[model samples]
Target: MDTQIGCAIKASNELVKNLHRDGFDRGCIATFNDYMTTFTKNKASLHRSLNGINNAKNGTRLYDSIVDVIQIFRNRGEVSRPWILVVVTDGDDNISSRSLHKCAQETSSLFTTKESNNFLFLVGVGDGVNSEKMNEMASAGNFIYIHAKDFFLLELIFLKIANKITTSLSLSLGNLTVGDHSASWAEVQRHRNLSKVAIDYALLIDVSASMNSRVISSNSVTNLNSVITHATRAIGQSFDSRIINTTNVALLASWIDKKRGNPYNFSDLPFEFKLIHRASRDGFGNDKFHNNCDNKGPTIVVIKVKYSGEIIGGYNPLEWRCVKINEWSTLLPNNHDFYIDQQRRTSKSFIFSLTNQTISRVTLNNDAIIWSRNKGPCFGLQDLCITNNFGKSEQRSYENRIINKKNFEIEEYEVFQVIDKRPRFSIFYFIFMIFMGIFKIIKFIFMRLFLGIYWTCYIVYWIIYWITYWTVITLICVAGIGLIVSILALPIILYLYLEAEIAWVILSALFIYAPILGLIGEYLVI
Candidate 1:
């Protein structure tokens, strides 16, 4: 015991030295067995006190010591510095006047304060220590519990605690080698390569000027405008980018999803493009445009200026719904005009010019898209508005004007709905999927049946096991009671009758065979 006490004191002194070296210059050391003695933060004084603890104490008052340490910290008043309390015990509490519950309450109250950073570590040493009780106390106090097999391991444990405290107090670069740094850079490059933007784009070419020209074909001179119109019609088979295979829908999807913070990788899925409304097909009526493209998710409107040959368009993330006159009136009570344009707010809206290859994002998030009953899809207050096939472009809510021309007649205008493409499956693949699903169902049923059988057998085994165990215990308890009765009666029988050899023999038999029977019963139960 004395040697054990000396080892504990030596380990504690080493811990204090290590803590002081690790920049924890000010700390309190409290030693407790039956009673506790605290030493303030002086290196020499702490060492002297630790060396003076030569004798070993008999009782362990663990709970009482914890309360005392908490009280000492509280008496220090308010402190900005971090507080760390380390409690080491070799045995369970034997002389603690303070209940475990009371000590836990004090510990919790002391540690869970916003005043300063507080840390508590409870360490149990040797096989005699009650680890479960220590764990419970640590959990209640919101501290850490550590167990050491012997007193010799305390040095390593204390050193680790000092290192932990130092690490928490300071910040430093991690253990990354040059190779690791290079590997990290390579990973970043790989991520950048994989994270390319997905896009859905349309090319609107101007062929209006070709109307006045003539083209010399292999047979004869033909009208160039007619040939051009025929080519445009052939290209306008469907707005489906996959069918066209000219524009990169993946790039557009990636860009949009990234900007909107959507985790979905649109590049993995093909885009379904449908030309909802074309001015040539549906006439240049605003009502017709809204009726066809109103509830459609996202649409791209592209216009080819008549003479300038400038191709400009805007991306509306929201559906274009015409605001009712009554709703518009309520929205803008000050406005007297019969025509009221509904301003839609969105940060994702953007306009671009194919000719200039410039994209302008909406500067003012609010009023990004405007919807009017009289005008076809309007963007940013006349930034770009189409009414009866005539379009106007003026920079207002957007960063830059996509088209220089303020007002121009659209040679051709098309609105295409941007949607995720549905996967096409072959008949064979569909049949395979059906078979796989059936197999999965069969597997699930078999697994459930197996589990049911296993649990049933397991329950039966435990039932039999408990029954045998109780029978053995009952026999051992009866034998113990009989042995006690026989011993108590033998003393009286021996004093009362001098020639009680039969009773002596019975007593000897009971003492010898009772233990043998109990052992046999224990073996059977086990």
Candidate 2:
């Protein structure tokens, strides 16, 4: 038992260091089975004492162990940092007074009081382990339930859990709305991929004559038009000078004529071709973008920006522009429409400075743009791929098809591939099992049966309604058909039995009349 604890701790320590995660601080180590020892910071002494420790005498009290850990967190008064509680058990609880539900509630409460980043890991090894109880004891987010038939797999499971924790802590998206903003944090955490991929991007910039003029309301060192134009030009220059010439980049431009709100054609735009190339075709060919990026292996990306005049007031408002990308779209209009700048009272202008990319810009929408020093593809591109698989150019669309044996082929795939990976049993399966078990016990105690009586009554009702109606209707239809057949055969029967020529004449008339009557019945039903 002590060896397992030492092995898990050692593996976790090594993983944290190897993954470049913050080092872990040694916390209290305690064991409980309807009883608990005081938590000690001296992990070395605790491990040394583990060998002498004997098997717990009583039944496994999983709840008590969880409560002890929660108590330790409360005593330490450290609510800001992340804490993890790992419970390893081999059998079900039998003698503990504390119910499993109580333990889960306490676990949830403990984490709720903190920053909500705490974790719980329940490892159940060997047969007779109660998987349901273990799952119940684990709090939702970052918590995991691992089941292994042997102790040998425990070490591997611990290592996997440690790796997950390390990866989660490494990618700190400062203010990016990924996990915390979602309704289900556990689901969001499951699909998070921190890996970076190259991107093939398109940039469309607005460079109208308005960009060269000063703001209508203010005096500034630089015109609102020049700020965006220079900033965009600089961005284009960086892409051309810093990036490889073979990089897949489609540049387009939109412009305004002398009239306000009147957009100009790409050819009429008065801009240097060196800064940006005009789009050759309307509705940019998504197919060609992927083809150009195939050799380079860059994720597909597109961005369109429109400068809609200047924002009236704010700390960093002058250079604001409405930007839309394939991954996300924002209408950052250059005006105070969402909220009035109460601080300025009257609308005032802030000088636009495009030097620092990290300097927070003021826009109607409070979205922050992450600028990379490497001038890599937009970071939001990663979010799009992780959440929606939006940038996988190799993925074939509905229009894409293959001909096999000179025949057209249709291919189908799972929509939510990530969610589909998780297997689920029908809820009715559990309900049936639980209900049957409880009903048997109730019948045994009360000397009265409920299910059997209910089933008998239901069967009797079904026979009275459905069976009687179907049987009577079937008999009536069979009789009617038999009567018609017998009536037609009567003439033939008389001719054989009576030995009369008149019987043959009656036989012909009977056959003709039977057909006419049948046709009349059919027409009436229709």
Candidate 3:
């Protein structure tokens, strides 16, 4: 939905011309066509108001353009049945002759300041756009802009808009229901008809109090999850969970909650760092693991390596550390912009290597992880370029010199997975999860087989304890399942029940937990 503003103007000109040739009333449409032609041809000298701004000869004359467009609405009304005017730039108000404050004040009048899906929709294109200013210019759904790249993407935006205005561009053969709406587009090509992709993801967002108060859009459910999963998969990473394979990835999720002026903090981060209570639950640490992260409790087990290091991650610049989980893991404020030089910072964290101090785009799927959405994680004025060298390092682990923050020195750590016989996080990730899973199995099996008051009750209680552990169990888990056995105090409890030969207690435990413990133990084996 993004294209350069000028490109949009060009698109409008073409569409109107076609409509005029198609025998549609050319009076009001003609007015827009003429204004656009003048703006494009004599752009240097054109003092325009078609874009709702005055003297928009340079970039700043939107006031006049807006006035001109609004005039057409007044004369004809109904805006010729659904036209669009998208502002495709960061509203820096740099090239404008009018001050932003003045433009903002006047622009609010261009469209009815209500959310009734009336008037023109204002879409701020690039990070430079003053969203507030854009909001003032917009009436409702009509005012939206797509951030432009080279002219290619702009052209796509125009085509998409044309399709939207004319007919339904996207159609679902699947069991989707776009009920009681429009039919289909006349000229629409049924290309990009995706039947299936390798990966499918479902993000069960935790909309709890401890988490962000933002809600994922019902409209975007199917597409958003698919897009996000695909985006992650394209980087050879996994989704449906949080795992940072490499810091090189340009990470982004729905930052809409932040855009809606919602709360942001790490306490609300949907995922936790602790290893799962069950062995196999290691972030799906199976061969299917797309990304890599140490399941070890959030510890600063930094490794200094003499070779290439891959495991790299930084707090998302948009995310903040929540309350301290430990000496190592602390809560990050949902808002990192406070310490940032620019309010519109892109990426959750400022990465190194761009001359412009912007978070460098993470290259994946043979395409750089460029952003199309603009919200909490959108780029800022200072973040347009990469901060420093990108791709200088590869993987983090032993077999290669890794810089352990704890030691502040490059050293070796166990290679969980093997890449060139070097300990890379991706491989390490699978190994760690598998190892933990196996350990859990052995523990559960032994606990059930040996500790005999109740095979199910004792094991079930132990597994739940492992899952609910709020304190220091990660370091303990890796050591072995033996520790879990000791920590839960199962043998002692089992002995008490058995010694008492308490018929009521035995029946109570069975009614409550025999099946549960059996399941937990079997789960480990599975």
Candidate 4:
């Protein structure tokens, strides 16, 4: 045993005695059973019973020491710190009148439940110690039976207990709200090429008269072609200016035909003769905006596709002038409308910002301009691949399709605010995930169970419920068809195959399940 621990116990006892309180005070110890035996200090004491039972005061000594400490907070409301009982025993309390179980149970219950008792620590030393009984008296992780012999090791343990009782922890909450003065937003790009394929991008800027004024001066672009040229090169394949001409970039302008004064002719359409913010016949390209600040919010002006013709999901085309600012739309009157016709697409009602806000903005519903090349023949919907700076353009040689060899870091968007948040999908997302996992496991077990004498009753029960209700009826029918086919097909399939006979038979038995199994019709397979 550590010398420091024994000293701490003695010192703690002294400090506890001087404190004044009743209910607020806590600390107690009870030694019991056929294990630890405390010795008396006096040699001249005579036994009242003469058989040593009356004279043995081991239990009394422990009880007195515990009560003296517990009495400090016994009558008061509460104490500032926890009350701990440091129990050091040679072995089990064999000489005590009470059983070890009773001692462990009642003592622990009283001190903790008592207003003064908030914390506890128990230590058992050496061989023959009743560790299980000690565990019952104290919390599992809190109770420890030291492997050393005697009271020598108390210093290290009690000091740790003292440290734990004094520390405090808390959770604090506060964040930005909508309509705050500062409206910031953010965008992300792959730090490295996610794929070695050619990278393509498009920047759609608002060439409206409002955006023509220079940042330093009121001078607007006199030449529309010059603004297009500057923007295309500014946002091309790489940020490095030296290699700008070497890269392949295509560009398109929004309201190009509208500005050209002949909106009806497709020949004089919004698309450009050269690739400036434009896509090829395949529809993959880039858009770089030299003119900054679109006071008009999120809108589609340009688009980008990659490889030969794959337009992967990236940013929303309906952003304000297709610019990446923390807060552009909510602070300004210029947000665009949704695309004309698309499925599974959300209205551009809310913009994602780097910060939160409180006030809503005003805008027109029909003002949204959609720049789509989907109508033209050269614009193959799926075939046109305008590349982004996707790095290596040759990645099809791998045998393992799931492996991504490059270390590509994507830009992470720091959530700005809670605008138009969907609570319905949020609440059930976790539940849906958990249900799918359990369903998969149950299906696996059922498949294995069906291979035995359990096939007929299973098939018969499913037959009844599958036709019972509308919601579940179709599911039952599907499962029934698949199940019946499996049972019938397995036998015939095995008889034809030589090497694969048993294997196909086993494989075919597990194939009779619907996407939603027992839940669909409330199955009964005993």
**Top candidate when judged by lDDT against the true structure:** 1
Alpha-carbon TM-score of each model against the true structure: 0.34, 0.31, 0.26, 0.23
| Candidate numbers, best lDDT first, in rank order | 1, 2, 3, 4
Best by TM-score: 1
Query: What is candidate 1's lDDT per residue for 209-302, written digit by digit as tens?
Result: 2111222223322433333222222222222321111232332444455444332222243555567887766888888888898989888786
The local lDDT score (0 to 100) that residue 489 gets in candidate 2 is 70
- lDDT tens digits, residue span 1-526, model 2: 2333333334333322232211224344445532233434443544443433334344565566666667776676355556666666666766456676556545544553343345456666556577655543442211345565544344445445444443345464333231221212233233223422111100011111211222122323343333323222212222221111111111111111122343332223433223121112211233332223222311222221112111010121112122223223255454433321111111111111111101112221222122222221212211111111112111111111111111111110011000111235578878998999999898786665666787899999998899768866765676577578777876776665577567666776576466656655654564
Per-candidate local distance difference test: 0.60, 0.36, 0.31, 0.28
Structural RMSD, model 1: 43.6
For model 3 the local lDDT of residue 303 reads 16
Which digits, one per residue and each the tens of the lDDT, describe model 3 over residues 1-526? 1223343345444433322222222223212112432212222222222233211223434444454455454444443233234333334444335443343334333332221222132323333455544432331112332333233233334344433333221234333212211223223223213311111100001111111112222344554344333222222222121112111111111121222343222223333333221112322222222123222222111111223232232222232121222333346554332222223233322222111112233222112122221111112222211111111233221122122222221222111221122245687798999999999999999887777758778899998888757333543444345445445656656776877768856675565455456555654664
Residue 302, candidate 3: alpha-carbon lDDT: 13
Q: Go through the candidates in order and give the clash count of each.
A: 11, 1, 85, 76
Model 2, residue 420: distance off in Å is: 10
Residue-level lDDT of model 4, residues 354-471, one tens digit each, is: 0110111112223222223222110111121122333111122111111121212111101011112124465589899889999999998888787654777778778776656654
How well does candidate 3 score on lDDT at residue 126?
Answer: 32
Q: What is the lDDT of candidate 3?
A: 0.31
User: What are the root-mean-square deviations of the candidates from the true structure over C-alphas?
Assistant: 43.6, 33.6, 29.0, 39.9
